[model samples]
Target: MTGTANRSVERAFRIVDELAENGGGRVSELADRLEMPVSTVHNYLQALVETGYVTVEDKEYSTTTRFLEVGHRQRHRLEVFQAVSDELQDIAAETGEHVTLLVEESDQCVIVAVQEGPDAVNLFAYPGARMPLHAAAPGKAILAHMPEDRVQGIIDRQGLVEMTNRTITDPDALFEQLAEIREQGYAIDEGERIAGMVCISAPVLDKSDEIRGAICVCGPQSRIDEKRRDEIADIVKRSANVTQVNLDYV
Candidate 1:
C-alpha cells in the first residue's frame, strides 16, 4: 500500500526465488543462501504454504502450481502475445526450426510463446525464459525499434553481459548493429546467445509504429548457413508482419 518497498515482502520474495532456482531447500539452507535469518525464512515459508503458493514436505520447502496457474492466466491476457502466438507454428513449419514470440520486459527479453518444428533442438528458450537483449536476435530486433533513451536505460540497467564468445559486448558495436537492423528490418544472431546456434528475428509494430514485440526463428548453424540465412530471414519477417496486422483486430 506504500510507495516504498516493504523489507519483509522483499525477503519473502527472495526466499521464493531461492526455492524456485534450486527446486527446493530446507529452511536453514534457504536462509544461508539468501543471507536471511532461519526463523525469518521459516515464517515466510509457512505463510506461503498457507496461501497455496508454496508447499512443505519433510521440512523441505518448494514452489507450488499456483505460479504456473498465475503465469498462464496473465500470458493469455496479453493482446500482442495472442496475436503473435498464432503465427509461431506456421513460421516453425516453414523454417523447420524453433520459433518464438518475445517481448522486452524489465530490460530483458522474455519469451511468451514458442513452437518447435520436426528438426527443432531443445534450447534454453521457453515460455517465461529471460535473456539479455544484446545476446540474441529477437532482443536486438525489439531494441532497434525502441527510443534511444530507452535503449540506453536498458543498457545501463542490464549492461552488455556476454553469453558466449560471439556475443556483442561492446556498446558501440551493438549500437551499430541495431542501426543496421533498423535499416534491414531484421536482426541476426550467429552463435551469439548460444554456440553453434543461429537466429533470425523481425520487429513487430503497432499502428502507431511503436514496437509490440519480435518474432524469431532459430536453429543449428549447420542447417541455417549463410546461403539459407536470407530465406529464413524473409520467412521470419513475413510472419512478424502478419502478426503486426493481426494486432489491430485483436
Candidate 2:
C-alpha cells in the first residue's frame, strides 16, 4: 500500500481505539485527540459507521454492536474456558477454594471464569481481571508451558513489576522459577500478587499438546499450609487434566 493510504488506515484505527478507550466521544474531541481537522475526523467516523464499526448516540460517537459481535465470535472459537466451566466449579466445591480459568493475551493473563469457594475467605481474582504474566500462579503456569522466545519477549515488554515482597522482580530468577514449574507440572504464587493469598495452578493442554490455558485454586495463605499445599496442588493438576481431556474431545 502507498504510504499515504497506510497512514490513513492507521489514523482510522487510532480513532476507533480512542473511542473504545473513552467509551464515547464527539467529533471535536476525536479531532483534537488525533491532531487532525474536524472534517477529516468526521470523514473517518462516517466510514467507520458505514462499516458497522462505530455508532453515534446522542451526538456522541461510540463503538457499534458489531465490535461486540466480533468479540463474541472470537471467544466462541476459543471456547476452552466455556467447555470447562462446570468442571471448574466442581473443583472449587470439592476443594473448598476459589477456582479460576485464565488465558494468556499479549503477555497478560485474563481471567475468563472464576468460581468462589464455599469457604468464607475472599480471593482477589475475578472474571475480567487482567494480571501480569510473571506475578500470578496462573500466569506463570501458562508462561512456563509457552515457547521460550515468546516468554522472553513478554519479559522484555512487561518487566516483572513487584506486586508484593514475595513477587519475583529479577528476570533470571523468574526464569529459573518458571523452569522449575515446567518440571513440576504446576506453579505456585505464594503471596506474590497479593499478600496473604496463595495460588496453585496447572497448565491445560489441547489434543495437540499446545498450552491452551490454566486452572488455579486460590485461597488464604494460612489455609494452604505445608501439609495442605500438596493436596491442593494434586487437585488443581487433576482438574486441569480433566479440562484438557474434555477439550481434546471437542
Candidate 3:
C-alpha cells in the first residue's frame, strides 16, 4: 500500500463530512457543495450507504450513528479522560457552570468530556469538538505547561487566528500571559473565543509533570465577574489538581 493518503478514502470522508455538516443533501446538492461531479458524488454516496455508514431519506443523504461508536470507544481509551470522568459532575455541581475536559491533539484542544450544571449556559461545545489551542482557557492552560519549543511549533502551524475581538493575536502578549498562567497555576479566558463568556482552567499533569489535559469551568460575564472569577479559579484549580492526583495513581 502507498504511504501517501488514498484519494478515494479522502474523497469518501469528505462526502461524509459534508453530509454531516449540512445535516443532509441530495446527490446534486452534494456535488455542487463538494465541487465534485454528480456521477462521482453518487458513487461515493452509494458506497457509504451500502457500508451502513450513511442513510438516505427522500433522496437526501445523511450520516449514520456509526461515528458515535468509534468516537465513544476512542474517548474511553484515553487514560486522562478515564481519570477525570468520575469527578467532573461534582465540579459542575459545585460551580453551577459548564465543565469541560480537553486534551491536546494535533496542536489543538479536543473536548472529551463535558458536564453541564444547573445554571449552565447552552453552548455549542460538545464531546469530540476541536478548537485552536490558544482560543480558550483550557487550551491556554494546556499550552502554558508545554515546552517552549513545542508551544512555538503549534503557533507556527496554527497561526493565532483571532476568534473574537478580544482574542490574543500577538505572540509576545500570549507568551506573557502563559507565563502568568504558569505562576498562577491556572488560566482565564475573557470572551477570547466567545463574547460574554468567561472561563477558568487549570492543567492536569501526570506523575512525570507532563501535561495530560486541562479542566475548565465557564459561565457568562454577568455571573463570572472579577471577584467570582477568582473564586471559580480556585475551584477549577482544586478540581484539576484532584484529577491530576488521580491520574498519577493510575
Clash count, one per candidate: 0, 0, 0
Native-to-model Cα distance after best TM-score fit, residue 4 in candidate 1, in Å? 8.7
Q: Encode model 3's per-residue lDDT on 163-186: one tens digit a residue.
A: 999999999999999999999999
lDDT (C-alpha, whole model) for all candidates = 0.90, 0.87, 0.91
**Candidate numbers, best lDDT first, in rank order:** 3, 1, 2
Clashes of 2: 0
Better of 1 and 3 by TM-score: 1
lDDT of 1 by residue, 1-250 (tens): 5534487778788888899999999999998988888888888899999999999899988999899999889889888888875588887787789998998888989999989998999986778999999899999999999988899888998899989999999989989999999999999999999999999999999989999889989999999878799999898888888888889999
* Model 2 steric clash pairs: none
- What is the Cα-based lDDT of residue 120 in candidate 3? 98
lDDT value, residue 108 of candidate 3: 94
Q: Which model, 2 or 3, shows the larger lDDT?
A: 3
Each candidate structure's TM-score, on Cα atoms with residue i matched to residue i, is 0.97, 0.78, 0.96
